[model samples]
Target chain A: MRTEAIDPPGISWHRVSPKYVTVRLVQWAIENLITVVVLTLPLVFVLLGWWRWPPLWLAITVPAVTLVLAVWRLLLIPRQVRAIGYAERDDDLLVRGGIFFQRTMTVPYGRMQYVDIGVGPVERGLGLCTLKLHTASPGTNASIPGLPAAEGARLREQLAARGEARLAGL
Target chain B: MTANVPEAGAPSAVPVAPDGEWLRVHPASPFVRGWVALAAIGFFFGRDFFERLLQGRPVFEQDFAGRAPWLVAGGGIVLVVTVLGFILTWYFTKYQISEGYVRVNSGFLFRQQRQARLDRVQAIDIVQPLLARIFGLAELKFEVADAGESAVKLAYLRMDVARQLRATILARAAGMVPDPARPQEAAPEAPEHPVLSVPPSRLIGSLLLSEQSFFVVVGGIASVILSAVTENRGFFFYLIPAVLGLAASYWGSFNKGYNFTAAISPDGIRLRYGLLDTQAQTLPPGRVQALKVAQSPLWRIFGWYRIQVNVAGYGAAGSNGETASRTTLLPVGKLPEVMSMLALVLPDPGTPEPGRIFAAGLSGLDSDGGFVTTPLRARFLAPLGWRRNGFATTDSALLIRSGRWWRELVVVPHQRTQSMALHQGPLARRFRVADLVLHTTAGPVSPRLTQAGLDEARSLFDAQSARARLARKRQISEQWLATVVPAPVVAPVVTPVVVPTQTPLPQQSPQQEGPQRG
Candidate 1:
């Protein structure tokens, strides 16, 4: 899963689980399920002949556009998931993501205050978790997603230990 | 623990002993603190009088003889209760200056006591608000290296006492032990060398030509034209608020920037400014986290520049004039003055030719002056500033320059860099260019170097990371330990930081030494 196009040499990069694509698709489906339900309400009312001033075609436009957007996002999810990756260097950690807007952030071990691991229902079901690194500067938002649960735990322990050892007490 | 209480009417005359003796602030502290309440009371009574006069009901003329007694009695009660509250607050609040910390034991019911460590001192500001100035008193604020909130605030101290206390506290924070034998001479005040002073004319001119003023003018004109075109008088109402707000903001900047002067002393860079409510700020060594030099398109005509800095303990500069003043280095300065202030803060620019490289960072372009600019192929991403936008490195600091019209230069020392980022958007990927951002503490100067070549970005990513690590490991703690550790004759040289790569980017190597500022 090493992307030859983006990964620099000398450091081993770790890609998130491919199953994350499914987790994200499920999460997206759950989030947009509400929009689809709400948008369908009006359409249902019109179909049932319950007082509707708007035309049937006008009502159809709303759900149609929503479905199109949902489909577009569904199509993009896999590549976006593939783009997510994190790397650990000697004295710092690097996290990069985003398809159109690629960003790589480096958080030095000394500046890290603590390490956090997050797991959602879908991620838990897929045996995946997210690892977040906190630094003194609030802007140091370095988080890695779709990490395997075991790998996430290991990385958290390793990062916490490294942070304590190199803590500059910032 | 037991402090001698001065009479509620009499002023406290204790000197800054630093002998672990608790001392009460000026007795008038409470009155000064209660000014808001007094103003509210004045408004209430004055409103009644004004309303009666407006109604032609004769406030003090017709019923004065009968109502005088009741009015006097009610006023007396209010005055008595207010004085009682003041006395209660005054009796409890006390502060102590010891060896390693300054403590304020205050609060009425909760009995709150807060202390700020001497070593953790970030900056000391002596503020004289209009009322305090009239009363010949000042407020001493001790900014500790905590979250931007001021740790210790000693309000309404006699002006002379506040100055002496500040000098004593700063000396202790610097780890200088006062010669106890001479109680009269507590670490003799450090001599100040005047560096630069901004003239009133220049300050006014800068204000008139500032970006805010430009926006205000544009907004005012647009609103006026709209009102005329639409023939709606309602549009005129918006002008009242906008003009009032603009007037208030202009006055704030004027009050804060008037007679701005910067000086160098052993303590740090001392800045004294403000017209009505004067402020003297002392930023000790290592307190400044970053620096930025900027120019507006309009200011280029007069060659005026602005320099601002970030310190750990100061809150972010906002609409408040005091906070804005805290971050400002030179409200309005010429190039030489700006350069001098920069030299003082960084001290070692880590270059054989500091002036030339700085000049390049300010205005040089086309990869001249050791700056690695964006490749020509990527000019499509930023056609206006592709030539001007670039980054450079001296031994101790990273210099980033950008903006074709409103030119800007940011300097972040390797040691002060909190973190860094490398990013490339889809557009940039096409041209094989990326942006590098060096993050410092919370401040206005966001040191982002844009459109660096892809290869250069990759190399810089690894190299800058290594440099930041090495720099942090070597930087000495800001806490001066003069009492224990002898001052080094020469300041320790940080790791010799360069671009690290031997082969410079194509045009960067052939760049000339001196700046060709447009």
Candidate 2:
């Protein structure tokens, strides 16, 4: 991995690094499973005659719709995986992502309350980790997922140290 | 099901091993089986047997062969399920204290683990469910202020353990000597400082006077009558249960209200109460952010007032474990106690005199409570009615206002006040009234002092604004002195150099410094 520190003197804004693709993919998988299950379950029930079996044409139509959706999801996954990024500027850490409705969030390091490094079973299986940043302000928490465990720990330490320094200054 | 454990070389706080005998006394656990058994009997044998008898079906007829096996199978399933539930309930329920936190680990397939820090705990309430009270056991519910969750429950702790734990946590948090270990010689005279208990008469009086209780009783009766008419049931069966429930609830309310006394010690204010499961909460005064005293029109006849405070970590009523009660330090509404409590908890806002002076100047109302302003500006809204209002102040400023419709009372600290603005709407202009908005860095503290007299309002706004600006300027100078001056001799020498920049420094200083350093 290559690390670069860019300080464009005139620009005050922060941007996240583009290497957060793994995080986006992990999140997408969790969210997509629910959608897939909800779409597929009715067809299974109909075929098994659990309640009342649907007409043959209706059964065929539902499966066809689900198949098309699955194909569409497969094609869009890579582009979404590529868009994730995070960056830290002088005053704030920025997290940027989303393909359709782009979102860029800035959290001032001075206001950070704590940092957490977590790994779930799927992420651990994939050799990935997550970093959750919390602040005193409610409803303004950000999580960066899909980094290597060592990298996640290092980033958490650096961010926590920076937060302590800023709080001491105030 | 075991997964890979992380390498144990990391320097982190060691997880304390839990201590004490693994014991539980859940009230519902033992009797819950009995209810299930009764339900099964009712669902199967009783219902089928009664229905068959009513329809004149024989016990050992030709159709009995097919039905008997199905009945036997169903009974076996019910028995197995009940026994399994009882086993799971017994195995999964346990709580223990380890180090400075209480750890509760439970659930069967989906496990839940919770740890609460003793120090962060605000209050602990023990709830005795209707069934639980019969068994002489209670559920200990902990209210932790900064715990990132609502409340945690330890099911079926012996009432003694729950009380001991509450006292232990409170003593440790407040840094007080444990009451249990106090010398025996001092115990006898301790009763001299009598516990302030509300008499039975007073408790009933308070409940009857409460608008909340009145609403409950009226609503309950209305619902019972409507249900009886709609369902076409005999009034006896339906109304009896409703009446009984209400009576029980009313008694519970009275019992909780009976011992409500807020006593102020040097440490904090302690409030103690409860009928089935008693609770005591101690809150330090400094933690309170804002205080409000409110009264409805009905309560105003009896000079009753309800006081509420915004304390950090104190959640709204139902969201936390506290049900049907406000997050109130004082439950009983009284005027004299409210005044004394305010004086004890909050800093002296200097006296009622400042508020009187400010109110008089803004209202143009005489000491006899008569309006001295012209009819166009000052029109009386109410002649006889309950007024919702109060006065507030910081150390350096005061404010007072009273109105039913467009009500406000704002006080901003002199140094903290940022800017003042005069706002005029079309209706206000017709009445020669203007609203003065005072802005503070913290937030806006605006009081529409009087709407009728535009001239007087504007003049007062100007006078207040000037005083605010002067105070702000003095504060800034003092801050500058604190930041800039250090050593005795170095201060005078460096003061002149800093003074130039304090006024306005050109951008050239940065450019000059870059070349000089190189």
Per-model tally of clashing residue pairs: 0, 4
Identify the CAPRI category of the predicted complex in candidate 1: medium
Tens-place lDDT digits, model 2, residues B1-518: 00111223433421111222233434355453356675765577668778878899884678789888988888777777777766566456555443345656566555566667654555555555545666656666665544234456766655545554554444333332222223111111011121244456656766676666678778768877887778755655656776687677778776666567666543356566666545555554343333444455455565555555544344434433354342565555455665565555553454545434433322323321222233332354323111322223334553544544332234344443333344454555555554444432110123334342556554555455455444434442211222234445323323442223342322112221111100
Instruction: Report model 1's chain A TM-score.
Output: 0.89
Candidate 1 per-residue C-alpha lDDT over B1-518 given as tens digits, one digit per residue, 9 for 90 to 100 = 11342223333433344355567777898888789988887776678888988999866777589987988788778878888888878766777776466877776666777777886788899999989999999999898755467898888788877877888888777766554455445555678899999999999999999999889889878888898899999878767877888899899999999999999988888999999999999987767778999999989989999999887677677665567788898998989998999988988788999898888888888787898989999998999999988988888988899988989999988877777788888888888899888777666677888999988888887788888888777654555545236554212212122112333322122221112111
Runs off by more than 4 Å, candidate 2: A1-170, B1-76, B146-149, B175-195, B199-290, B310-314, B318-322, B339-391, B394-518
User: What is the alpha-carbon RMSD of candidate 2 to the true structure?
Assistant: 19.3
lDDT of 1 by residue, A1-170 (tens): 55533446665668899999988888898888789888878888999999475689977889889988998988999999988888888788888788888888899988887788999988999999988887655567788999999999999999988887777634
Q: TM-score of the candidate numbered 1?
A: 0.85
What does the lDDT read for residue B478 in candidate 2? Answer: 16
Quick one: best lDDT, which candidate?
1
- Quote the lDDT for B7 in model 1: 28
Model 2's interface RMSD: 15.9
lDDT of each: 0.79, 0.49
DockQ (CA atoms), all models: 0.53, 0.02
Whose TM-score is greatest here? 1
